[model samples]
Target: MKKSLPKYFRRFLLACAILLALFGLSRLYFRLTDDFRLSNITYKMPYRQAWEVPEMSEAQRENFNEILNQKFYYVGKGAQSYAFKSEDDKYILKFFKFKHLKPSFFVDLLPSVGAFKIYKEKQVERKNRLLNSVFDGYRLAYAIHGDETGLIYIHLNKSHELNKVVTVHDKIGLVRHIDLDEVPFILQEKAKTTRTVMTELMNNQDISMVQKRIKQIFDLYLLEYSKGIYDRDHGVMHNTGFVGDKPIHLDVGKLTEDDRIKSKEFYKPDLLRIVSKFNIWFKANYPQDYPTLKAFMDEQMQLIFEDERV
Candidate 1:
């Protein structure tokens, strides 16, 4: 009996060892074969060198002018900006000057700093694509080319005046005209006015108007956050305003992905703060509108939280 007990114990030990080995082998296989590329793909700037504006070939120059001529509306300039219409007539372009590239001495770090601006452009592209897919009629705004330099020539025939058609200032670059009346109100302003305008709109009491605007604004931010867009210095909530009865999103530079997704500082706290302030402001100024806006925000946040879970 004792000898048979030892044999059975040996068999049990051997079976356990085989099972663990098989499990480890399966895990290793998956670790190697699964879609790990996304995890490994780090965004590093090309090692060649710092980007310099490439000289335009003759063909490239012609194509560039053709693209500009075919698309774009000319909006009037602000102190440091020149606006244009996007090809689709759905977005406005704000070109920044070289002087606007002042470094943030405190937070500027490597890898992230080099990738920041480009990441922002990519983020806008992702958000626009996602929103346009999820919301049937919604079209999120986008930033066009970040930086390009070249000599621009204007041909004014007898029918058109060069000055009236296009204004070419050395410092400001070229300003071309296209239809932009339908653009969101927020897109037309400097960054400083974004929060104030949003707060004012939230405080308006008209139920129908509040509902429409709140939906637009909420969708706008949802699109922004889902695409992993975050601007550390500016703190998300870029620009806002209405286009007709609907709200619009604008000024989407400085967006990027970060490890802070797990931190409350990233989304929850900031979102709560924005909503709380908005509610307070709404209650004080337009007591009648406060409930509608509050309800809209509550529903929107619920949707956001569900999406985050998935």
Candidate 2:
């Protein structure tokens, strides 16, 4: 305060302050009005029947129904969904996040200048596109790679008939009673992430056993590639998981049906993107095992690239 700032600098600071205040107020308003009940959700699988998968037999339906009746423990939340693991540890239910479903009414209040309107329209379009993409991806995964994806069922609308409820115990020790009848969720077979599984294997199992498991995961990836299914989200670590000995794509939202992914040129780079990170981590943490595993992986990759069967 000893020396006053220049006029333009002061103006810029004042503008920044105003913007910050507006942002704070907007956040507060959203927090205050946050509706946990999700009563105002707009999309509801409009034309499609709620349960359209005719492939599910009566026994499978009964099994799913029995599982739904049990209480579930809360798993971590992601950008798109809030995940919960079943009491029996056999299933996972991912309820779509409220933030993704909620409408942004502020966009409606903006004046309709040509550029502004177009901008707002594009935002809305993008939001819808993301929502649709996730739903469509799940459906496609279930249809094409159900075993690999562990996708059991997709519930896209509110219904009293289902009346599925769960008791969730979160990380903070808070208990939440949620009615799945109101929540849009995907039911899937439970799995541990690839990173977690791999770490445990490295710590507990012999190098040969670890190599076998890793090769199985690579084979699974190659199989999916052969089927023309590609996971847009690098399906190596977080997005991929192990259900027993089989590696499955856990994050099904970003899967895309691209035949080009079958080509070795496109596949190698995608494979390396995650493996290169692992290679560095292995060298630093378990230096003795690194060279052996690295050479093994290189040989396997070369074999994969050379094999015309994909």
lDDT of 1 by residue, 1-310 (tens): 4445587899999999999999999898655433121112112222221112344577855654454454445444443234555454544444432122223223234244556756655554664443223211111122211211011221111111111222222222334232222111122321223345555555453466555655655565554455554433233233455444444444333334444543544777656655675677667877776777788777777776665531
Clashing pairs in 1: 73-85, 73-177, 73-178, 74-177, 74-178
Against the unseen true structure, what C-alpha lDDT does each candidate score? 0.42, 0.75
How far out, in Å, is residue 168 in model 2? 4.0
Candidate 1's C-alpha lDDT? 0.42
Clashing pairs in 2: none
Runs in model 1 lying further than 4 Å from the true structure? 1-67, 70-80, 84-91, 102-206, 232-238, 241-248, 259-266, 306-310
Model 2, C-alpha of 12: deviation from truth (Å): 23
TM of each candidate vs. truth:
0.39, 0.77
